[model samples]
Target: MSHRMERVNQLIREELSRIMQREIRDPRLEFLSINAVETAADLGFAKVFVSHLVTSENKKEILQTLTGAAGYFRGELGKVLTLRHVPELAFYWDDSIERGARLNRLIEEANRDSVNPSGE
Candidate 1:
């Protein structure tokens, strides 16, 4: 990615976070976090990666809510962003944080086994 694209991605992420915090009133979005934003080279669309502290049971519902609100988010972006065109937002559930925690648990278990060696 070029420097300009990086800047654009960062700007979009920040603006989206702000919008979510101040504008969105959905209870499902209370603990949501915008993990990252990846915009296409032509600025036509963006893939927004997001996560929440809520249970996995609510993951599908949360994603659905975010996807349904994409248009509103884009409209809000248009009002704040100076870009020639506001990219279409696509919401995706990001599991990187969960994956990292799982990986850490595995590593710790491996270390414990290494020390014990014989299941004592």
Candidate 2:
């Protein structure tokens, strides 16, 4: 990312954090963290990635809820952060945490197999 894009992404993250905490009345928005933001080169759109601390059960419903509130979130972002263009905001669930957990489990299983090669 360019320096300007990085700066803008940081500002968006901060402003969204504030909005999520103070402005959003939706209970579905709770227990979530704004993980990252990707702004298009033309600044016409932004993809907001979020991570939820809650269980993966019903993860699809959670993502649906967040996406449904995209317009409200974009409005909040525009209100809090003054920018030439507040790009259309899109929400996505960041799966990095889940990927990391899966990788760790695989590594652990490999290590255990190496330690006890013979079948018990």
Candidate 3:
């Protein structure tokens, strides 16, 4: 990605985070975090990667809520952003953090097994 695109992504992420924290009142989004944003080259669409402390079961519900509120978010973004067109918002659950934790646990388990080959 070009430097301009990177800046755009960072700007969108920061603005979205601020909007979610101060404007949105949904209980399911209380602990939400905007991990990253990837905007299309033409600025017509954006993929918003988000994460939350809620249970995995609530992921679907959270996404639904966000999808439902996309328009509102876009409108808010328009108010704050100077872009010619505010890209459509698409929310996605970011599980990289969870995956990292699981990988760490597996690595530790492997190390433990290697240290005790005979299964003490």
Instruction: Provide the TM-score for each candidate, comma-separated.
Output: 0.96, 0.87, 0.95
Q: Which structure is stronger by TM-score: 2 or 3?
A: 3
Q: Per-residue lDDT for 1-120 in model 3, tens only?
A: 999999999999999999999988889999898999999999999999999976666999999999999999999999989999999999999999899989999999999999998889
The C-alpha stretches of model 2 lying farther than 4 A from their native spots are: none
lDDT of 1 by residue, 5-108 (tens): 99999999999999999988998899899999999999999999999977556988988998999999999999999999999999898999999999999999
Model 1 accuracy (lDDT, Cα): 0.93
Superposed model 1: Cα runs more than 4 Å off: none
Q: Could you tell me the lDDT of residue 64 within candidate 1?
A: 91
Q: Give model 1's TM-score versus the native structure.
A: 0.96
Candidate 2, pairs of clashing residues: none
Clashes of each: 0, 0, 0
lDDT (tens digit, per residue) of candidate 2 on 1-120: 899999889998888888888877876678788899999988889998988877667668878987888788788888877788889888888989989999999999998889997845
Q: Which ten-residue region of model 2 has the weakest summed lDDT?
A: 53-62
Alpha carbon deviation, residue 101, candidate 3 (Å)? 0.8
